[model samples]
Target: MEISCHKIASGKASGPALVSKEPISFLGTVDPETGEVVDPKHQLFGKNVGGKVLIFPGGKGSTVGSYVIYQLKKRGVAPAAMINIRSEPIVAVGAIISEIPLVDGVSAELLDLEDGTLITVDADSRRVRTEEG
Candidate 1:
């Protein structure tokens, strides 16, 4: 399946998708050094987001969440890319500063995707493509 989205950051990434139902706040919800989801309330808590295409509804919480994303990147623990249903300033700024690909306004295919589906986030073209439709 190929889904179109608005480009929030420009880059390209491909990997297994790590889908999250809840919105994320990088500062407290994710461990910057480990890239693990740490928010107990989140279904994906305890899972590592590193090396995967992190998919979530959107970002919530502090503006510092951007730096946390950058921190994750600097620590080599950030997601390969990020996709969101709505790209808010917090996450969009984070992805941009951290050089993580980000695409937003994509929720349809995301809802149907399996946990570990291999997907490509082509932010340069504002598209997310899956092997299966």
Candidate 2:
């Protein structure tokens, strides 16, 4: 299904979804060099977000987390795109500076989608779709 949402960044990306049920604190939760979720307490621990469409509730923790996201992009390990139920300042700024496609105001149905489902996000168009559609 094609879902309408608010655009937080300007770009288009398609990839398998890496859904995270919890909010992410990028600075400590993700490894910039490898794109792995390093926080053992996180449900997504041990998973690599690289090249996927990272989906989560929103961002949490320090504003420095924004730079971490940028670092991931600079290191070529950032998610292809991102979707948030709500876009907070940190993640919003990160996606903007990193040029990663990002959208928020997504419906809860999106969070229920299984991991690895093909997802296409067109932030420029304020739309998201699943491969099944």
**For this target, which candidate reaches the highest lDDT against the unseen true structure?**
2
Position 11, candidate 1: lDDT: 96
lDDT of each: 0.89, 0.94
Steric collisions counted per model: 0, 0
Q: Best candidate per TM-score, number?
A: 2
Residue 90 displacement (Å), model 1: 0.4
> Every model's Cα RMSD, please?
1.5, 1.1
Candidate 2 lDDT by residue in tens digits, 1-133 = 8989999999999999999889999999999889999999998999998999999999999999999999999999999999999989999999999999999999877888899899999998999999852
Q: Lowest summed lDDT over 10 consecutive residues: which window, candidate 1?
A: 106-115
TM-score list, all predictions = 0.94, 0.97
Candidate 1 Cα outliers beyond 4 Å, as residue runs:
none
Candidate 1: Cα lDDT at 82: 93
Deviating ranges (above 4 Å) for candidate 2: none
Instruction: Rate residue 6 of model 2 by lDDT.
Output: 98
lDDT by residue for model 1 over 1-133, one digit each (tens)? Answer: 7889899999999888888878888888999889998889888889999988998899999999999999999999899999998889999999999999999888655955787888899998978898742
